[model samples]
Target: MPDCIICHLEITDPNNLFECPNNHPVHKECLIEWLQHSPNCPLCNEPYSLETKSNLKSDLDKREEEKKKSEEDEARKERNNQIKIIAEKIIFLKFLNMIETLIEKKDFEGALDRLNSIDENKLETVKK
Candidate 1:
């Protein structure tokens, strides 16, 4: 039985086909209708164009590289943020110790002067 040129559907009366050496029947009406201008098969995947393969591979590689770079950037930013938080804590503790020493020496004025230079959260350390 003759089949469609593109999809291999059974050829009806209005449809006619030409035989290809690959044994896949191709309808004349279907040939004119579809797959003639197109490159790939409708059902079975077969490489019809070399340029399509090349472009697809190149595009995929670029996308993968971009994804990797994005992940690395996120990791780096997290590490930097962690380091900054630790440094801020260390600086706050040192400032608090200095304020405690000043206040113990009955240098409340000096300590208050330092407190005025510092922010409220830093002053909260002395209050604690």
Candidate 2:
């Protein structure tokens, strides 16, 4: 059994085997990953054919697009969370200001009523 030079693992599947111009064998998956870093073979330093490089380049491009999309999604979620937190804080501050105005007017009953109507869950989110 021939071993893939890139992974030092046995080429279990003949269909998954790839060879460089010098006939150095490597796993197709490993070579695809390796191509991202270099265009040359790991063993012989020979460049892969244009067709092989083009196919591998296409695969690498798809992987990069997927990675970028995933990162963008994560960033958008983080931004939304930050926006939500800011909105909550703004609401909480407005609620506090209203209470303060009531206290200044000697309207203790109104302030107490407003405090009672406060949503505890929303207050907890602001606290965090």
Write the residue-wise lDDT of candidate 2 on 1-128 in tens digits.
Answer: 69999889999998888888998988888988888778899888999888777757777787778878999999999999999889988988998999999999999999999999978987798988
- lDDT (Cα atoms) of all candidates against the true structure: 0.63, 0.88
Candidate maximizing TM-score: 2
- Per-residue CA lDDT of model 1 for 4-89, tens digit only, reads 64775887763354443344555654443333345454444443345433434554456567778999999999999888777777
TM-score for each candidate, following the candidate numbering: 0.46, 0.70
Q: What's the TM for model 2?
A: 0.70
Reference-based lDDT, residue 21, model 2? 95
Runs of candidate 2 exceeding 4 Å displacement: 1-10, 19-26, 34-52
